[model samples]
Target chain A: MKINLALAQINTKLGDVEANLAKHLEYIEKAKAEKTDLLVFPELSLTGYVLQDLVASVAHKPVEDDPVFKHILAASRDLDLVVGFVDEDSRHRFYIASAYLSGGKLVHVHHKVYLPTYGLFDEGRFFAWGDAVRAFDTRFGRVGMLICEDFWHASPPYLLWLDGADIMLFSSASPGRGLNDKEKLESARWVERVTKAYASMFTSFVVHSNRVGYEDGLHFWGGATAFDPNGEELAHGPYNEEAITYTQLDLNQLRRTRARLPLLRDERTALVQKELDRILNRG
Target chain B: MADINLTLNTDLARDILSGFIKSEITRVGLSRAVIGLSGGLDSALSCALAVAALGRENVLAVRMPYKASSKDSLDHAQLLIDQLDIPNKTIEITDMVEPLFQLDPDISNMRKGNIMARERMIVLYDQSEVFKGLVVGTSNKTEILLGYSTLYGDSASAMNPIGDLYKTQVRQLSRAMNIPAPIIDKPPSADLWADQTDEKELGFTYEEADKLLYLLVDQRYSPQEAVEAGFNKKFVDTVTTRIRRNQFKRMQPPIAKVSNRTIGYDFLYLRDWGT
Candidate 1:
């Protein structure tokens, strides 16, 4: 099966959901016109990153009645959307979350499990941590969504893979920092390395969408990319600018890659779990 | 101490800084920038980058010269104005600061210099309103770390584009921006007094200071670690102390916390909040 995906690398207005929703609608129309099956946005595409006190003000519930999600759900009937927002639960706990919407209905929501609080980041002080990582079946295939920092940890993506996710959608509002020897931002280089490694190791399609533009002092380098099951880059957006990057992924490549090197079919879950239990109980 | 790498990808740095100026100024509901052109490398580089971000038409270069300010300073600033062809104004700050100096007859050079700097800021801010622009700052990292600027004087600005770049990096970027060769090659000076230069005032060259500071701050090396890395022990100690002492110049005034969410303590929000 072939699925067309578009990475909408957007610059969100800080704490203004109305403006961001309008931009999302415009991007959705552009994606639909291009016949894309799935459209992905960077983390907090609806609410800007670097939001400290504005977190509570911008938090939304991904329901049919939400002001932001209402327009998103209406636009999702023709295409699938993986959108990022601040999610407020029934208990008033806020989380950095991304929701998967298909056929004008909410499919799955993944709250970011890891909140970075060191060196210019303060997410841990603001939002509640997500406690679960699970894969859900989409119309095209079984897929998983991981926000930035969640995929930085190995266990979240590994859990999704073991739970039978063939496609991993990663999104981030990563600010550009640390110029490298190759004139590339170090954060971008490290993220691309890990995404490519994940795709090759798990033999699954890895798609990444990082935001662009500046917020306060932070500059988000927009270089969205996708890697096929063979660990080759299929598409790459421009650096330091906003653009939509589209790529078509063939599910047959997964079968071919796994047939040659069956990393996923090694059947070692029981041994891994036993070792993990032993390691945890050592104290 | 080991030599630290102070090299930057000038192309990437230029683009990043330029984009920062544009995004920040426009985000604050202003499309134009008002920069005080001191005819020095730092201000020249800042003006060029502002022109790169906001077109020359959108950037206003204001030259505020006191009575003791060098002729070369004004001439070099004029040269940059001609090169970029941006709108510019020359407001002599002698009259603005003379009254304050007259009130205190025995004022030291430091007080007079500070008064001049603050007077220049008043002119720049006044022009910022007239031009409908934000005040773009030109202070580089090396001096800021050493606390070489007057508090609320040269350090004050609506936004700074080159504050993160050290003095050495500023010269490199200025050269890249094609600022006048004389401006980049000239000995660095605050030009507060007739004979004042930054290196002479700071007791060291910016080159050595930049390398030492890169280790101490960027590399997170302690004073002992920095001395071991080859920086002089006295230099390390003095530089570290200056950074600590000038901490007030780098931050907003501390507010006493009484409420649950006091500003800057628990009432955390970015400057870009709600914009």
Candidate 2:
């Protein structure tokens, strides 16, 4: 099966949900025009990232009940969307969350795990950690979803791979940092290393969408990318600008890679299960 | 693996900062700036950036020298003024502050230094109105975190062009911009009292503090992690404590929250939308 995916790298304003929803709709239409099946936006695309205390003002339920969700549902009849927003539950607990909307409804919702409280990240101050990572059936294949810091811990991807994932999507609001003497974006350079390695390690396709623009002085460099099961980059987007990159993925490659490596065929689940039980018991 | 180096692309950094100055000021519907030129590297760099952004015509460099301030301070400031081709003024602050010092007759040097620092601010802000320009701040991230500066004194300004840069980074950029060697090389002094260099007063050199700070703040290492990374335990603890203790100086006076939308909390909006 062949799946056409579009990565929407956009600059989101802090605490401007309506304006952000408008940008999302515009990109959704553009992706539909390109005949893309799924469109993905960066982390917190519904409300700009690093919003400190502004998260309280913009937090809301998933697209189902959100006032902005109606417009998104109307636009999604032709395409699927993976967008990020600060989610609030019935009890008013806030979470850094993302949703996969298809055919005018939310197909799946994934709350972010590993809220980073260190260095440039303060998600712990504003969000509750998500508890599980699992893959669900999409029209294309079994797909897994993970937010920015979730990708940092190899366990999430490992669990999703064990659960049989053919495609994985990652949303990020990473700031542009560590420029080199040649004026290259150093953070993107490092991100490329991890994305490529993860694709090869899991033998699954990976799509990463990062945001762009500046808030106060912190800059977000959008270097959105996607990699095939063989760890080869299929497409790349522009840095420091709003861009949409389209790439076609062949699901057959996943079968070939898994057959060749036989990584999943090897028996390690029992050992992992035992170790996790032992570790948790100790805790 | 332990080393990290990020010397900014000097030309690009200069262009970016100058652009920021232009946009931020013009966004508020003003095009002119008033800077306190202290004949030191920080103020000199600030002056140079303002000149590049607003043009030499729109910048006013005022030198307010205290009684014990070195003659070289005035000369170095003049050198910058001549080089940048900006209008300059000299205001002696001794006459204005001596009366306050005499009232106590035997006040501590720390108290007297603070009086001078604040007195300088008063004159600078007055000139800001007469010149129809905003007072540009020169506080770098190092002094700001350390609380080495007197609050509402040298720290007062409408906006800051170099507040994010570390002292070490400031030195690099100043050198890249060709700041005078004397001002850049000489020991950093607030010139509150004679021989009162910043490093001496803080009991640590900027080169030393910058390395630890680069590890702590920029690299985001925990206090123990910093010590493990080869920094002195006491130094790391002292510097980090000062940063935490002085956090109040970093922000505006915090307001009580009783309403649904407070000014700084839920209502934090960009400058583009004016109240």
Candidate 3:
């Protein structure tokens, strides 16, 4: 049950949704050539991040309604693709979402939960938060999907773990600043450590992909990484560089690790929920 | 429309300041103006121009502080006021801001920082009413081009004197005016949060960012040309993208085109519209 995963770190042009989609298609072809079981792309890969008001004009409807998405779906008939795009709901609110495509069918969509409104980021001004934590059943395994800032929170992944997801994929378009080198490294290390810990606890493989190159004032530092079920770093990409990182994961090895670890089986959900409720209520 | 140009020298700076202040005053029809004295170089130079145009008594300096603001910022602000001998007042906004934060604890530190900035503006505008003066802005061209100031916060001003000068040019002008060297050399900051610096948040030194910006925007260099000119491609792209992305912040709200001569919709006027 070994599967290969490919993370595409592509530089995207801002506001050029068509060009970006073309770039994504090219990368997908490259990933397919490399015999990738799952191909992951960075957040907002279709239109680029920080488009400001342009997101309102350029954001597409669901996959069925969007012609570009239809093309992507048609091209993805033979590949398992995880790509980010702008999704506009019926209420006209846009969302930063990643679509999972398998066998030319839309499998699942994960909306980015955390809309960063801090310095140089105004995602909140343009996007609405997602409400569901979904783990779709795939041929490789039970795959859990989360967008950037979604994995930043502990609750969503923890919930997906409880839903019996055997593998996790996270995508991001995190920007880089020169003075924030230490902060960036610390955040990357934190993501790695937390995902690895989650993987070991749930006996799952975790794959994370981020964009590279500069968009506006923010530089997307591409540091895509992965961890096996035993919480070991399998592969990592270079920071501030575009790359396609590949890793092979064995589900049989994950099962063996789960059996040996036995951490998930001894879980206490009711108590955890109660404690979480208490904390949320306190705030 | 002959592409107005001036030499980057002390005499030219003084002449430009004099003309700019008079034009702005005449355009707004306000005899007095109020400025938030942060004791930073931008404000010191702005205060000097305000005094030169409206006299020391006609200019009012307001010092607003939060709890975590550095003592040195307050001291320097007071020193500038004393040196200029302008009528000024100090107001602490910590108490006003803290209670609001207590009501909504989920507000992030970043949002809280923005709230502090807006609070300071609220005081400035309020004092503008009290003193019957216009709120003078101190933001330089570098910050304005980069969209570094908070919109409707620090960016909200009746009129700005140094909005067209780069940060390096501001320093040069400050030296010509004989303003304190400490103010000019100090790390530029908004003093929004404790130990927060602008260059730290922007990720590059002001000198580098400003020079790079001048090359790309003013000198009309393409991204490739800027990179070939010894600037990092990533840095150039970042600055250019920021300027493009934040262009909306620098203009009036987008309007629906209904009238033939609407203010921002159809009838386009230069910045010195009334003047």
Candidate 4:
């Protein structure tokens, strides 16, 4: 199977979810015009990152019954979309989440498992942690979703591959920090290294979508990128610009690599399960 | 070809900074600005950025010189005013601070400098009410991190434009803004005491400090790692220690966290208070 995916690296204002939803509608129309099958955006693309108290006002559930989401749901019928928004539960507890919409329905919702709360980030104070990681099938292929900081750890992507995902997509709102020899921002280079290594190790296609623009003192560099199953870069977008990069992912390449490596197939699940049980019980 | 040459696109920088100044000032219900013009690169860059944002007619550049301040300082400041054609005033702070300094005749030059800084801020803020403008700050990221500024003194301002850029970066930006070449090339000084240069007292050049700071702070390299990256161990240790010790100046007065939400602790966030 071949699928054309669009990476929407956009600039989002803090705590303006209504305007942000409007932006989503416009991007959906553009993606549809480009004849793209799936479109992915950065983490917290609707509300923006570094929203300490503003998150409370902007947080909302992507419920189908709501007219706000109905506009997006109507637009997603022709073009599937993965968008980031602050997911407020019925009890009003919030989690940073991404919604996968296809066939005019919210197909799957992935809550961000990792909430960074260190220097330049205070997400732990504002959000409740998510508790699940698994892969499910799409019309294109079996897919997995990861949020910003979750992929920093090797376990999340490892679990995704173990759960039979051939395609992986990540939503991020990473800030640009430091500069390399050519005076380029450093974060995107490290992310590219991670993307290639993950794709090659798992023999799966990977897509990373990021946000851009200035929010207060923080600058987000929108260098969204994608890799094929063989770990080669398929498409790359520019930095610090609102860019839409479209690329095709070939599912046949994943089949070819998995057949050659057989790393996932020849695995001992029982031994790993026993270790995990012992580790959890003792902890 | 240095270890980290951070040269910004001046045109882009100017636009981003002017936009930031406009938004920040207008959000606070003000269109004008007041700056403590010290004839230094940091102040010059801040003044230039303010003019770009709020025009020359709206910016009030107050030159507060002390009894021991250099004549060159006044001349350099006037050069900028003549070039920008902005309204400026030279206020002598000798009478304001001399009364306190006289009480303790044995006070160190550093103490005297602190007195001068605080007194200048008082004059600027009072003028802020009169001029109907915010006090745009001139303290750069280097001085701020190293705590080379006096608290509640020159550090107090309604907003700061150059606080993120290092001292070296400030010079580059000043050149980008077409500031006078002599002002950019002059040895840095607070002009608190005669013949007092900033680097001579600090025991380090800003070029050395900027390079090490770029690695240790911005790049997140350990002090030992910075030494490995070709910086001196003494310089790395000194820079890192100052950054850690001087972190208090970066934040507001610490409130005792008694409740779940305390102002300046858990509440009164920047976005909540301003934009």
Best by DockQ: 1
Residue A172's lDDT in candidate 3: 85
Candidate lDDT scores, in order, read: 0.92, 0.84, 0.79, 0.84
Which candidate order results from sorting by DockQ in descending order? 1, 4, 2, 3
Clashing pairs in 3: A176-A219, A216-B241
Ranking by TM-score: 1, 4, 2, 3
Model 3 lDDT vs. the true structure?
0.79
- Give each prediction's DockQ, rounded to 2 decimals: 0.70, 0.19, 0.02, 0.21
Instruction: Give a tens-digit lDDT track for model 2, residues A1-283.
Output: 8889999999876788988998998898889899999999999999988776677788877655679888777777899889999888888888888888888888888899889998766778778888989898878878999998898888998888888887999999987666435465577777777888889888889989998766656667788999999899999997767899999998899889888987768849999999989999995
What is the lDDT for B146 in model 3? 89
List the candidate 1 regions with Cα displacement exceeding 4 Å: none
For model 1, residues B1-275, the per-residue Cα lDDT tens digits are: 47467778888988999999999988888899999999999999999999999999999999998888999999999999999999999999898889889997899999998888888888888999999999999899998898899888899898899888999899887887899998998999989888889899899999999998888888798899888888888888889999999988899999998888788898877788766
Summarize candidate 4's per-residue lDDT along B100-163 as a digit string, tens digits.
9999979999899899999999999999999999899889988998899999999999778778
Each model's interface RMSD (Å)? 1.5, 4.5, 16.1, 4.2
What docking tier does model 4 reach? incorrect
Better of 3 and 4 by lDDT: 4
How do the predictions measure up, each by TM-score? 0.98, 0.77, 0.53, 0.79
The fnat scores of all predictions, in order, read 0.69, 0.13, 0.00, 0.06
User: With candidate 3 superimposed using the best TM-score fit, by how many Å does residue B226's alpha carbon deviate from the native?
Assistant: 39
lDDT per residue for candidate 4 within A48-103, as digits (tens), equals 78777877777766777775678777888898889898888888889999988888
